[model samples]
Target: MAAAAPPHTDHKLGTPILDQPQLQAGGGTAAVTEKARTLDHISDNFSKYLKSAYDDVNKRYDLTTKEGLAKWLVTEQQASQDDVQFFKDGSFDDFIRYYMSGSASVMRPPPPLDDTYPISNYFISSSHNTYLTGNQLSSESSVDAYKNASVLLRGCRCVEVDVWDGEPPSSSSSEDEDETAAPKPKKEKKEKLGLRKRLELRFGRKGSPPPEDQSKPAAASSNQSPDQGADMRIEPWRSNVSTRAEPRVLHGYTLTKDITFRAVCATIRDYAFVTSDLPLIVSLEVHTCPEQQEIMVEIMREYWRGMLVDLPLDSSQNSEEIALPILRDLRKKILVKVKRAHKHPGAADAKPSTLQAPSGEPQRSSSVVSTSTSSSEELPDGTKKPPAPKAKISEALAKLGIYTGGYSFKSLDQPEAKIPTHIFSLSENTLMEVHETQPAALFKHNKHFFMRAYPKGLRLKSSNLNPSRFWRAGVQIVALNWQRWDGGMMQNEAMFAGTAGWVLKPEGYRSTSDEATQKTAIAHHNLDLSIEFLAGQDIPMPPEEDDPKDFKPYVKVELHVEKHEERNAQPIPGGGKSKGGEFKQKTETYRSQNPNFGGEIIKFEGIQGVTEELTFVRYVLSALSSSFSNCNR
Candidate 1:
């Protein structure tokens, strides 16, 4: 039964294998040779595993052969020479555990930032009703909400402020009087036009020449002489500015409490640039009278000093051909976006009535009234009438809306909607309707200008809509209710993870070509993704009292892609209505604190409509008996 065994030799290396352990385990030369052959077989399986299971790592490191992987582990991963030798000598499980625990296991790295593109081209992290810390209807508004949402969160760049007229001070002390006083502009005089010029303005200069102009030469009639029209001069028509109450921020038309607008401004000034130097967008919902609006403007100007971005009054910037400013140009600036008062055809020529006190009382010359009652009138029943419909947005406040001008959305086809500086705000439901009917139009419009979508009015509980729905259509400012930590907020956090509040959109969304607009889905790039559950080590126990042996671990894997559905487009095969649909798979449950999954592999083949850059894979770890789940993206 014991003929002498043959001496073992390493065939690949062409050397005799004479290790003492091998000699002892084998008990003879023939048994040692058999052991060497088994080691070679195990090494071959490990190489195959690296090529298939860790293909992404192989591609990343440019490794095509097992020898290359071994070299990389030693050189790049800093594995010891002994460890490499052990891997090559049949320690497959040990090598894999080491590699997976290191940096080689990272599936996604931080995305590179390209901030040179126009700000409209990026997805801005935004918050809706930023002052509300609870549900929309009855929440307490506080400045702390702004502090948390903007700086503490580290990425939100856009915040909302709904401003209303605050309660006036009880008595007009010297300090109170100074606070209510509006800063007046320096007066400048200009020469008014004579009758001939006035006639030309009323009619056309081409019409009948004036009696005084008939005697003049044809050249003088066609063009004004140096001193021809300079006859009478008067002060430019100025609005009778009245004293204002303190401006307040709150959720309008709700039971939400108010926070002083000055406090909000102070918070913004202190914390806006704390997390990121990128520009902060203050979306102002002005529900105040003109006087209080001016107070809002003064507060911002005083607090933000040089940081305020002054919007140019140039008409050309509104043209569709022009683009919004790039991020590189707007660093550390505060941009206010408020609804602009629409100018009618002859609005400039219409004379505004002087603001007079009620019942012929003396009007305050300093635009600071002694009491709030000075601005309101007593009704016949001794009750003051509700203040006149919130006055049109004041000129001073309108000027602060640099770059982003809030506009009421009518339709994409409207002329005003084409303005590059105009940001059309839409409710979630309205945006969904538009997406269903005219998705191509929505995508194309967002390419030139910004579109903001907020929660619908029915979201009284402050729930959030899936921002991805609007994001897929190239919507720039998807303002979510920051108070609720739901799936929408999770998705939002994932969207701007690496980038500081601004993420460049996908190429298809940024493209201006008609082909890009027409194509609703990304081209199918076939990829085979294989995920293997190797083992779980040191899994934490549940917080509550539970038996350790009863712990059963499982993982649910979900592949989320951009939902792309074209109206009237043919349905995808396998009863899928969308080209890129969600796919979910889970592993078998195992009962152990540290469970071994036994190398179970799940493969997804022919995945369609997925851009590696935009797609996300979510893994949810949970137990069968417990409702607790931990989601990782």
Candidate 2:
């Protein structure tokens, strides 16, 4: 027809354009072209492509048809008219590239802050030995540690300060020289002793004679105060040999250096609320004398001013009956957590002092007190000796423990454990023991009161414990060594990602009803997850490597669930098997800088856990021939 209009050809290629509409017997050229275009668009299958690219995009956007997708593209992604048409007409490569190139976030947005709950019903980010930058045994201490934790890290609500008696500024003598000046024979004799012998020598043993230098009386005994004259035996591990009487912060019983308490307080005051306005908890480990303790109180009062929480007056209300204040009530306040001393027989009747709040009416105070004492020493003949006397807490420092009163954790059945304002501190080992043996009780107790778990004393290298284990048991504060950025700290950062370091415990954990407990007991769920490894673009060569052509990249995916003995011990009522372990999968290696995985899907089925909220998925992109690996959570 018109010479069968020479089959439409591309001039540049000099080839027949197969995509052009074919001539039909009864249809006009325009109509044929339009029909062929519509059929081609249908053949391209944009819907299927979009679904594969984003598995849940349609469900998330409430999209049913192409029109809805077009609207979403225009409104949410700010697509141009031409781009919208292109997307609708089956051009998905550009869209996938945009999404995979970090143009859109793959993670769910952080939930809004919910501060209406009781302070006990949240997991607070905390740091252990906040002043130490290296190992627990020997490290340089600095106030900058506090600033890093508070401002740079942004959301550390609890910090530990070990306050010891500081040396006077005018003191010229150095303990290092004195120790070095000791007879070489004495040093050799000390080193020859066994562990038990050394311990017996450090503490006063029943049969062992005291060291000659320590046995001698002090020159200033007549003028020394009672606190200064007390038998404060020097532990062999302590490197701080200062005899001055100012309050300083350091790791007790270790070679860690010291930072002035005033500098610490000032640093904390200046940076505490810079990142978050939530209440800050200072876990005061008081190793100072009463005089220095008073100096600490004065420095805190001067630096914190109106921000420090005042001690509540003695009240008729039972501490066990009162509940902890909500987050709203403690905003912008600094709460000192120290072991409260037992009050004198009739100290409740004493007149108000500057320590008490200005209000004349009585206010409730926590009934918790520390019951822990120094460990008993072993005799030379292996007989057990009585425990050393417990160190006395200064009254001034004890009174500074306003809202949170520190208590030595014994057992969940203890009477003090029921007090709302009482906070129990447990070492990582003890925490693990309790979690494995009594998870239900620990979870229930944490719902009403606060509990903190710190790294055990044996973590001399500053390694961190797995915080997720304690978190699963509903521990409110799992203090970690912030200096190490290992898996534990990465998990911590993820837990507090979108909040001000305080994440509300799950509803089942926070609820106190019997039904809620039952719900939490069997909260396990089975999940089926499929991750599609599509393609890679412009992958960089490994550092220090010579050629990009030698790169062979692959991705390994892992699904990790924090497993606990408690959850496995009690299975769900429906006879479901415990599925609490790790799942790993990997993709085939590709030999190019821009590797195309070609839609290889990795499927994880029957992945189960006590709670899905604690599950984590990790992806590691690694090279087959190289040691380069990039990890993402």
lDDT of each: 0.59, 0.60
Tens-digit lDDT track of model 2 for 30-77: 113223223212112333555575556555554445676667666776
Clashes of each: 0, 0
Residue 381 error for model 1, in Å?
Answer: 33
Q: What lDDT is reached at residue 67 by model 2? A: 72
Tens digits of lDDT, candidate 1, 1-633 = 111112231111101122322221110012132233232222333455554655565565544456766676767666544444434433435445445442343433346678888788888888888888666656688886676422223457889988766655555457876787886433331125433333234223211223664334344334544664321111111322233347788865445778999899998898787657788899987766554666676678779987888644343453233457787888999889887654346754565333221243211121211101112233333444233233356555665666887766778987557556788888876787787677678878887688999886656656677676577778989998766544455567557654567777876677444444525434545557899887665565544527878788887776766544532322324433221227878899888766767789887887776655456566656664332222223
Cα deviation of 618, candidate 2, in Å: 3.3
TM-score, per-candidate, Cα-based:
0.61, 0.65
Worst 10 residues of 1 by lDDT: 365-374
Clash list (residue pairs), candidate 2? none
